[model samples]
Target: MSVKGQYSATIVIGVCGVGKTSVGHALALALNADFIEADDYHSAENLKAMASGIPLSDEMRLPWLKTLAEAAEAARQKRPVVMACSALKRSYRDLLRDKIGKVQFVFLHGDRDMIADRLVKRADHFMPVSLLDSQIATLEPPTSQEDVIAVDVALPKTEIVDIVARTMRTRQNADMTALNSEH
Candidate 1:
C-alpha cells in the first residue's frame, strides 16, 4: 500500500468533522509516511474564529495554505507525508499544487448530517458543529480530472484507509506505465 516511488506527499482534505485527521493518520501509517495535521498550522486568530462558529475568509486562509505547502515540501524531502487539511476549495488545492509539485489529494466525502453528528460528539476540538454549514457551503468537490481520489467517509476508517492505499497504488502504477510508454 505504500506509495514509495509514486508520490512524495498526499493531502487528506474534507469539510470539518469528516475525519480528516483520523483517516490521514491511518493513511500515513499505512503508507509509512509522515503525518501532519493542517489544523496545527492555523493561526490563533483562525482558531478563535472556528471555536466561535465563524468561518474563515479566503484572505485569512491563504497564508495558512502557503505555510502548509512549504511544510509539505519540507516533509517530502525525507519521506512521503500525509497532511490532513480542510482544503474546501479547488483554489486552495491549486495553490498547494503550485507550491509543491507531485502532490496527491484524498478527499473524504460525506453527508452534512453525518459529519455534523461526528462534530457534535467530538471533544477537545477547536472546530464547533455550527461551523459545519459554512465548511460545507464552501466546499467544491474535486472532479475526475483532478489529482484527487474521493473516498466515502461513512465507511469504516480501516476500510477507507485500505481503499485510499489501494487506489493510490493503482494510480501510481498507471502513471509509471504512462511515463514508461512516453519514454
Candidate 2:
C-alpha cells in the first residue's frame, strides 16, 4: 500500500514476537498514517545487549520509552500516526498517554508457542528469538480504562489489521456518541 497521510495517533502494542511491526505497518497503510518503529529509539548499547539475549531493565528502557512517546506525539502534525511499541506494562503506557491525544492501542497477543515460533523464524533483527521468553515473561496486558483493541496474533496479517481497523472505527463512533451526550 502507498503511504498517504497520518491517522489518529495510536500505539500498536504487544509482547515480542507478536507481529507488532507487521500489523502496525498494515494498519498505518490502511489509515494513511505514518508509522514509527519504537525499537529505533533504543540505544546502541541496549540493542547490543538485546542482541546478546539480555533483557533491558525498566530503568534502562525509561529514557528510550520517553523518547518514543515524544517522537510519536511530535509526529502528529495534523495527521494520524501508528506507533509500534511493546508498552508491556501499564506504567509504560501511562508515560505515553499524555503525548498521544485520543490514543488507542492495538494489542496483539498470542500463546508462548506461537510467539516463539515467529521469533525463531524471524531474521535480520537485533532482537533474537532466544529473548522471546524474557519478553513474554515480562509482558503485562493492558487493563481496563485504556483505549485498547486486542487481536489474536495467530490471525493472518491482513486479518489482524482488518480487526484493528474495524475496532478502531467502532471506538471512534463510541467516542463521538459520548461527546454528543456530554453536550
Candidate 3:
C-alpha cells in the first residue's frame, strides 16, 4: 500500500460533516501517506467566528489557506500527503495547487439532509451545523478539467478509502507507463 515515488498531494475536500476527516485518515493509511487536517490550520479568530455561527469572509480564509498550503508543501517534501480540507471554492483549490504542484482532490458530496443529520450527531467539532448552509452555498464544485474525483459521502469510509487508494495506484501505473514509453 505504500505509494513509493508517488509523492504528490492528495486532498480530501468537502463541506463540514461530509466525512472528510474520516475518509482522509483512512485514505492516508491506505496509501501509507502523511495526513494533514486543514482545520488545524484555522486561526483562533476564524474558529471563533464559525463557532458563533458566523461565516468567515474570503479575506479571513486566505491567510489560513496559505498557511495550510505551506504546511502541505513541507509535508510533500518528505512523503505523499493526504489532507482533509474544506476547499469550498475553486480559488482555494487553485491556491493549494499553485503552492504545491501535482495536487489531486477527492470531492465528497451528498444531499444536504444527509450532511445535516451527520452534523447533528458530530459532537466534537468546531464548525457549527448552522454554517453548513453557508458552506454549501459557497462551495464551487470542481469542474471536469480539474484533477479531481467526486465521491459520494453516503459511501462507507472504508469504501471511499479503497476507491481513492485504487485510483492512486492506477494513476501511478499509468504515469510510469507513459514515462517508460517516453524513453
Candidate 4:
C-alpha cells in the first residue's frame, strides 16, 4: 500500500491477509520504524470467536483496539512506528484518534476474490478463511478527511513496498529538512 508522505507514524489497515503485516514490516524496515501486529493483543475470547469463524462484535474489538493504541503511543515515543491493524471501522480508528493524532494511514484495499485468494494461501493464523466474509462486511474505507493513502492490493509486493517507502521517505525527509532550516 502507498502512504501519505510527511507523517511520523503510520498504521497499515486492511482486512486479514490483505498484506497488512507483510507490508507493514517492509515499510517499517524502510523507515527504520518499529512494527506491531494488532492481532498479537487479541483477547482469548476474540481469538475464540475468530477461530470459530464467528465474527467479533464492536464490544469485543474495543479493548483490543485500545491495546493497539497504547502500543502505538509507546512506539511513537521512540521512533516512527508502523502498526498493522485491521482498523475496519471508523469508530475503532476514532478510538485511537487522540493517542495518534496527525497519523497517516496506508489502506490496502481489494475485492472479495483477492482477499479469498490470499486467505487460501495464508496459513497458521488463528482467524480462519471462513471469517473473511464477515471481515469484509465490516470494513469501511478511509475517506478524504482521514489523511489516508489507498492502494489496490493487487500490486506486486516489491512494487507496493517501493511505492510506500519512497512516499514516506520523501515526506519525512522534507519535514526533517524543514526543521533543520528552522534550527
lDDT (C-alpha) at residue 145 in model 3: 71
Q: If ranked by TM-score, best first, what sequence of candidates would result?
A: 1, 3, 2, 4
- Estimate every model's Cα lDDT from 0 to 1: 0.89, 0.82, 0.88, 0.82
RMSD of each: 2.7, 4.4, 2.8, 3.8
Candidate 2 per-residue lDDT over residues 48-166, each given as its tens digit:
99999899999989999889977877787746789899989888887787655557888889888888888888888888878887887788888768878888888899998988888
Where in model 1 is the C-alpha error above 4 Å? 1-5
Across 146-179, the per-residue lDDT of candidate 4 in tens digits comes to: 7677888899877787888777667678867887
Residues 7-78, model 3: lDDT tens digits: 468999999999999999988888888999999999999999999999999999999999998999888888
What's the lDDT for residue 119 in model 2? 81
lDDT of 3 at 65: 93
The stretch of ten residues in a row with the least summed lDDT in candidate 3 is 1-10
- Return the lDDT, model 3, position 110: 98
TM-score of each: 0.95, 0.92, 0.94, 0.88
Clashes of 4: 0
Q: Is candidate 1 or candidate 2 better by TM-score?
A: 1
Residue 169 in model 2: shift from native, Å?
Answer: 0.7
- Candidate 4 Cα misplacement greater than 4 A, ranges: 1-8, 170-183
lDDT of 2: 0.82
Error of 4 at 22 (Å): 0.5
- lDDT tens digits, residue span 1-183, model 1: 224247657999999999999999999999999999999999999999888988999999999999998998898888889999998998998898788776788999888888889989999999889888888889999877667888988999999999999999998888778878776
